[model samples]
Target: MPRPPYLGWLAATLVGLFAFVIRMLRLGEPGEIYFDETYYAKDAFGLRTYGVEHETVENADALLAQGNHDIWTGTGDFVVHPPMGKWMIALGDYLWGLLPFGAAMSPTGWRVAAAVVGALSVVLLVRLALRMTRSVLLAASAGLVLALDGLHFTMSRIAMVDIFLMFWVLAGFTCLVVDRDRMRERIADLTAAGQHAAGWLGFRGWRLAAGLCFGMACATKWSALFYLAAFGLLTVAWDYGARRSAGQRGVPGRWLLFDAIPAFFATVGVAFVVYLASWIGWFTSPIGWGRHWAAENVTGIWARLPEPVLAVVNPLRSLVHYHAEMMNFHTGLSSSHDYASRPWEWIIMRTPVAFFYNGDETTCGAANCSRAILAIGSPAVWWLSIAACLVMIGWWVTYRDWRAGAVLLGVAAGWLPWFTYPERTMFVFYALPMLPFLALAIVLALGLLMGRDADDPQYSPRRRIVGGVGYGVVMLLIVANFLFFYPVLSAQIIPYEQWADRMWFDTWIYGSSGSG
Candidate 1:
């Protein structure tokens, strides 16, 4: 019941500042395109130049590098991902005038938006941790863990959608966390005033904002739909639980009718509308794939509908068809790649994807030097998180800790879905979205070790010493691991021996080989 320290804000701010500086430094280095940056960075430039993605030459990267930015073919590109993420990437291009056709192009300019979002995600995670546990030290610990994570750091420095998606995902989760606390307070006040059946928790602004964040997430990638669904149900459950705790009679039925139904509208329905809105550019463009599918298939039953109605309905139907094709592309993506990894291998940091690698001896300063951007996570942090998650599962099951359950819910939403498509070529970098929750799980476990705050009389002095020493050791290990892997994560040139030293597993040989 003690007041949380105001220093938490100052501490979290310092963490954010450090994260921003590290993420922004030399962000455009390795100047050449790397990994999926080929897709996203170009798509972003194309969007800025043409208002939609357009097909480019086979050597587009080479051409664009020379500042010959007029690379697009003017036709809409059949990209599987949504436009919102590319739009987010284009934001930096817009501000910096780095469009494909601009007189000069800067890769760093395109990547600045991602770096900004990634740094902000750290700040948000710190605040979320603080909100969840009311512990400033623990919150700063969470932020530090995330900032030191190689996967989050790698994704943040690139012109990628995953980082933007993570920002929105964290934002949505933060809103829900705030909503849960506010609802609990409202319930407690209502019960004290003998208003057991307070008809509705009028105008749940936080929940609505959560819905908006979910919508933005989906607009970045369809994968976010899973989070939207999981969180929607989770929020409804929180509402029902709050009402029951308030001594309301017929809690389940009342919640089902009033709270559940409205939550669907507030969260899922709003998200649906927002997802549709993201396709405005696609709908307006005749060149978008499947834009004419409805027109071509409008015979049989469609003939009966009015022309105006068909005009509205057909585009949506075409959009659905486009989604089906995109789904087929995703589900059937089993093409082999040097870096392709299975879902099961992701948690253990196996088979990390190499984003860039240069092994030239002259440029790198050794007989066998390597400059790499490998998307491997911190071993201590990631492996420790795996243990924390397992422990969290047991704690959640035994005592039903809401915090543990929430963290696990996010992990399941981001992770388990990949298991269903194991054959689909996935990589460890895709695990970026779940990193914050994993960090939270680790923090929650550490909190358990730390026992209660010393301000609480129940706290034991001997136990505090043991827990504090253990926590300090773990934090030091994580920092050391991050520093050890910093070179590989940031594409810093190092001797082959040193690079191989960091490759703790045979799967990590990709980091040394420059093949992946």
Candidate 2:
């Protein structure tokens, strides 16, 4: 009904900037490997040193802390996850290593990429929210809530690849949203101008971009496959609805012929290409695990192929076997972990993973001091989002609101798959990717509460006032909750009593509450 709120861009910029700075501030505190950092930081250094992750010297963590850069044992390590995320960590190493006193072993050097990507996710979410709501303030609120989220903040400051996975998944979803808007606009305009059947609406650039985003996401973590499938189906459903609304005949068949086929090429085929490209390091490296599997073990169907064809097919076959081994490892993993949580407990903030903990560091002005980095989310945000998601589900079922359906699908894709692997050991940070969509659910719920914009002919001031007040209160609670937990989230040195006081339940304490 009116010009789009372009001011939303400015708000997004400011929020993103704030998020980036805050994430980077004190990022190197404690200055040692914590939690999975023991694996990823060293693995990143190995990738940078050897092109593939290399086995490290015994007590490599201790050696790195002692400023030894020569920790390579000169053998490839059999890591579970893909190399793309390790490569992302290695980027920080490559850049920061150039500076004096900054090297791959430095916590800050390896962790920089996570903070940057995590903040960029906030920026992307703000813009996506703005596009969905057409409201400037609500968009910024989404960014702010995401920024203030304790889980997001903690994950951002770590060197783990989960933050990278979160960023790329959000990026892919954002690209799809943009494509939806552009395609729908084209169909509406063409139909209104008496062109009911506008075949092949040129190249959908945004959709292709989404493919690249998802490619990078899956490269970061195979779990991204869930989101890729969900979003692909979503965009296709949108295509069928758009064509049907435009009065085009045979909507289903038309969609299958034009939209579905092209979309498959754009997203699935392109994603496959990108996923292959991410393995260039491993493919080229002489020491990559299983790199020579095909050549070493040619049998059955492989033995039937001609030598010429076998040469060309060797690498692909090796990669397939590698993937199979990875799949087996993932499915069979049932290692007991203190902080392992069920998918249901993740939403309720039941058990938080303590990333770093130390009472020996003498900094606090108390005899008994505690310093820790805990990856727990703000309770206010998570609890309210559950209610917000409920409201969104109602809107989706009653009115078929595309935004609501999209948010719900995103949450389901990120979360539901874990239920199938109830035996798999999981952590709270694995739920990080779902946080952004919940933030959107909260914003979308607010929009439904407010009805129409103030300038609308029948806008309700009372509704706006009520919704605005409710949103403001929730924002306050989120900020306060985060601030209260900021000490533990950032590994700040606080009195032991304060740390114990912050723990409302025994499950929240990941380790012994040692006396300083």
Q: Using lDDT as the measure, which candidate wins?
A: 2
Worst 10 residues of 2 by lDDT: 507-516
Candidate 2 per-residue lDDT over residues 224-328, each given as its tens digit: 999999999999999998898789876777789889999988998888899999988888888888889999999988899999999889988988999999999
Error of 1 at 61 (Å): 1.1
Q: Each model's TM-score?
A: 0.95, 0.96
Alpha carbon lDDT of each predicted model: 0.86, 0.88
The residue ranges of model 1 lying beyond 4 angstroms of the native Cα positions read 1-6, 98-104, 511-516
Q: After superposition, how far is residue 43 of candidate 1 from its true place, in Å?
A: 0.8
Q: Residue 466 error for model 1, in Å?
A: 1.0
Candidate 1 lDDT at 407 equals 98
Candidate 1, residues 325-417, lDDT tens digits: the string is 989899899888778887777888878887888878455667889888888888888899988999899999999889999999999999988
